[model samples]
Target: MYETLASVDWARLQFAVTALYHFLFVPLTLGLSFIVAIMETLYVRSGDEKWKRITRFWMTLFAINFAIGVATGIIMEFEFGTNWSNYSWFVGDIFGAPLAVEGILAFFMESTFFAVMFFGWDKVGKGFHLLSTWLVAVGSNLSALWILVANGWMQYPTGMAFNPDLFRYEMASFWDVVLSPVAVAKFLHTTGAGYVTSALFVMGISAWFLLKKRDVVLAKRSMVVAASFGLIVSLYVVLSGDESAHQVAQKQPAKLAAMEGIYEGEKRAGIVGFGLLRPDKQIGDKTSPFYLDITIPYALSLLGYHDINAFVPGIDDLVYGNAEKGIRPAQERLDSGKIAVGALADYKAARKSGDAATATAALDTFNAHVGDFGYGYLEKPEQIIPPVTPLFYSFHMMAGLGFWFLLLFTVTLYLLMVNDITRHTLWLRAALLSWPLGFVASELGWVVAEVGRQPWAVQDMLPVHIAMTDISGSSVMITVFAFAAIFTLLLIAEVRIMLKQIKIGIEGGH
Candidate 1:
C-alpha cells in the first residue's frame, strides 16, 4: 500500500489534503455567517424569537466550523518555510507582501470581531453586537479578497520588477497585484461559490427539521432563505464560471486545453459536463471513453471569441503545437535576443579572469539554451511557468468540480421547486447534507486554481522553483505527516460537532 504511495510528493500531498479539510468549513463560514447575520438582524428588527433561536442554532455550528478551520489553516503558513521554502524565497518579496497585509488587516479584524460576536452576545448591546457580526462578515470577505489578490498575482502577475541584484522578483507596484484580472475574476467566482455553500448548509438543516416534524415555521423560513440565496448564487457562479473560463483561455490556454480535453484547434469545441479522459497514446485517437459530451458550438464560439466559427485550440494543438511555437519558443527566442553584445563581452572577460574553465562551461551551457550568439539580443522577461503535473491536474479538477456543482445545484433546486422543499423531508435532508459537497467543491476549486499555477508566483514572471530553499525532503515529510494526522482528528471533531448542532437545531433544542 505504501510502496506506490511513496512515489507521491508527500509534502505537496499533505498540503493539499490538509488544505482541503480546512476549506470544507471555510466557504460555509464565509457565506453562512452572513446569512446567519441577516437572520439575526431580522430577529432584532421584528423582535421575532424564532429568528433569534435560528441565529443561535447556526452560530453554534459556525463556531465549531470556525475553530477547526483556523486550527487546520494556521499550519499552512509555517509549511511555506518547512516544505515550500524555495517558492517562498523566490516570490517572497512579492507574495509575502499581500499575505502580510491580509494577516495584519483582514485576518486581525475578522478574528477580533469573531470572538466578540460569539461570546459577547449578551455582554454587548444588541445594536453593537449586530454591528460586530456584520463587521465580522465583512472582515471575512475582505480577508478572502486580499488573499485572492495575492493569489491573483500568482495567476496573472502584474506590477513587478525583475531585479538582477536580488536575483529574484519583487513587487514594484502593490496596486497592480491587488487589481490583476486573475484576482478580480477569482474573487467573484469564489464568493459566488461561498454563497452556494451557505445555501446548501441551511437547506440541509431545514430539511432535517421538516423530517422530524419539528419547528415547521423555522424549517420553512430557513428553506426559503436558503433556496433564494442558492438561486441567486448559483446563477452568479454560472456566469462567473464563464467569465473565469474565458480568462483562463486567454491567460492560461494550456489549462483550458486540459480542462476540455481538446488536443487541436477546432472552430467548434464541445462543452462537456461529464466525460472520461482516456489519454490516448496517439495524438488524437478515434476511440474515446466519453460517458457524455454535450456540445453547444455556437455558445462556445460566442463566449470565447464572440463568434461560433472562431477557432479554439485543443489540448493537443495547445500542448504539442501552439505551446512550443506560439508561447514557449517565441518567448524564449525573444528573451535570447535581448542579451547585449557588450554584456556578453563583459561577462566573458569577468569569467576569464575569475575561473576560466568553470566560467566557460557555464557560459557555453547558458548560450546553448538561450540560442543566440549570447550577445546583442533583447529578450522580454521569461513567462512564469508552473510545475507540469500539479498544474495540469489541479486545473482540470477545478473545472470538473465546477461542472459537477452546477449539475448538483440544478437538480437539487429543481427538486425543491417541484416537490415543496420542507415537505420532501428526505430530499431536504439530502440537500441539507449536501453542504459538505458544496463546501468541498468551492475549496477544491480554489486549490486547483491556486496550485495549478505553481512555479509561477506570477504568470509570465516569477518562478516557484527558484523560491524554494535547499531543505531535506524528510523534514518536509515529517511535518506533513504530523499536520495531516492532527488535521484529520480536528476535521472529524468538527463534523461531529456540526452534526450534533444540526440535530439539536432540528429538534428545537434551543
Candidate 2:
C-alpha cells in the first residue's frame, strides 16, 4: 500500500479529476456574475417590473452555479497542500502570495458583496443594491485575475529567483507576476470565454422559452443581451487566444510543436486544421515519422510569431538540436540541469564543511543551470515533448469551437437587429441546442491549456512526477473517486434545483 501510494500516475489522476470537476462550474460563475449584474443594472435604471423579475430569475441561477463552484474550487485548492506538497514547497514563496492575496482581497470582496447581491434586494437601497452587484462582478473577475496570475507564472515563470540552498523559488517582484504577459493574456482570453459561455447559456434558455411561447418579452430581452454581448466577447476571445499562442510559441515551443503535431523541424510551419494524429514513435525513436495532419498553410507561423515566414521549431528540433535554426536541444538543458544538481550537492557539502568560498562558487554554477533543473530528473530528452495527439485535438477543438461560437453569435446578433427574434423557430432551435457546445468548448480550452503543458508541472523547472507528495496509489485513487462521487451528486442536485426554478419562471424563482 505504501509503495503503491508513491505512484505519480495515481497522484496526477487525483489532481486532474478534482481540477477538471472544479473547472466545470467556474466559467459559468464568472460569466453569470456579470450577466446578473448587468440585468440588475437595467432594473435599477428602468424600474420596470419585468426587468426586476428578469434580474431576480437569472440571479437565482447564478447563485446555484456559484455555490457549486465554490464547493469544487475549495477542494482543488486543498489538494495543493495534500497531494502536491512538494509543488507547494518549491514555489510556495512565490506562488503562495497571489493565492493568499486572492483569498485576502478578491475572495472576501466577492463573498461579502455576493451576500448583498443575492439577499439584499428590498432590504438595501436601489443604489446600494446596484453597487453591491457591480462589486460582486468586479470581485469575481479579480479572483479570476489572481488565480490566472498564479497559473500563468507556472506556465511562464517570472518575477522569481531560485534558492538552491532552500530548494525553493523566491519572489523577486509581485507586480511582475501579476502583470506577466502570459497571465494577462490568459485572463482576458479566459474571462472573455466565460462571457461567451454565459451569452450562449442565456440565449439557449431564452430560445427554449421562445419555442414554448412563454415569457416572450423576457426571453427576447435576454436574447438581445446574450447576442450583443456574446458576439463582442467571442471576437475578443479569439484575439486574446492569438496572443496566448504567441506567448506559448516563444516560451514553450515544445507545447506548440505538440499542438500542431509537428514532428520534423521546419522554417514555415502550419497549424494543422484536422487529420488523424497517431503514435508515430515510441520513446527514443529519433527518426520516426509523426502523424499525418492536414496543414493550414502559414497560419501557425502567422499566429505564433506574427510573421508568416518565421521558423517554427518542431518536436525533433527541440529534442535534437537544430543548428540551422539555432535551436538548443533538450539534451543540452538536461545536461545543464544535471550540472546544476551536482553543483547544488557540492554547495551543500562545502557549506557543511565550513568552506565558504567553495560553497559560493558551487552556488553560482547551480544558479547558472538551475533554469533547466527539471531536465535533470528526465531519463530521456524525448520526455520533454508533451503528448501530441491529445494536444493537437484539444487545440483544434478549442479553436474550432471559438469559430463556431463567433459565427453563431454573429448570426444571432444580426437576426436580433432585423426581425422578431421569437418568431424565428430555426434560429431559436439552433440557439437552444448550442448551450452544451459552450460547455464543451470551455472544457476543451482548459484541456489544451493544461494537458498541452504536460511533463512539466512548472515548465522547464519542475515536472509533475517530481511534485507529488509521495502518497500511496490507494490513497490518491480513493480521493479521485471520492471527488468524482461528490461532484456527481452535487451536479445532480444543482440540475434538479435549477430545473425546478426554470420551470417556476420569473416570479416564483425568487
Q: Mind giving the per-residue lDDT tens digits that candidate 2 earns over 1-510?
A: 334225678777777777777777888888888888888888888988888889888889998888867856777679889888899999999888888888876668988888888789789999999999988888888888888999999999999988776889999999999999999998998888888899899999988888998887888888888888888889899899999999999988988988887777676677778767556565335554444666788888899999988999888878988988888888898999999889999999998999999999999998888778889988888989888878778888888888988998998888888867667799889999998788888888888788877888888889888788877777788878888898888889888988888888765648
lDDT score of residue 169 within candidate 2: 92
Q: Cα deviation in Å at residue 58, candidate 1? A: 0.5
Whole-structure CA lDDT of model 1:
0.66
My TM-score estimates for the predictions, one after another, are 0.81, 0.96
Once model 2 is optimally superposed onto the true structure by TM-score, how far is the C-alpha of residue 292 displaced, in angstroms?
A: 5.5
Full-model lDDT for every candidate: 0.66, 0.84
Segments of candidate 1 deviating more than 4 angstroms: 1-8, 282-292, 320-420, 454-458, 462-466, 506-510
lDDT of 1 by residue, 455-492 (tens): 34345443333334455556667867787788778878
Q: Candidate 2: TM-score?
A: 0.96
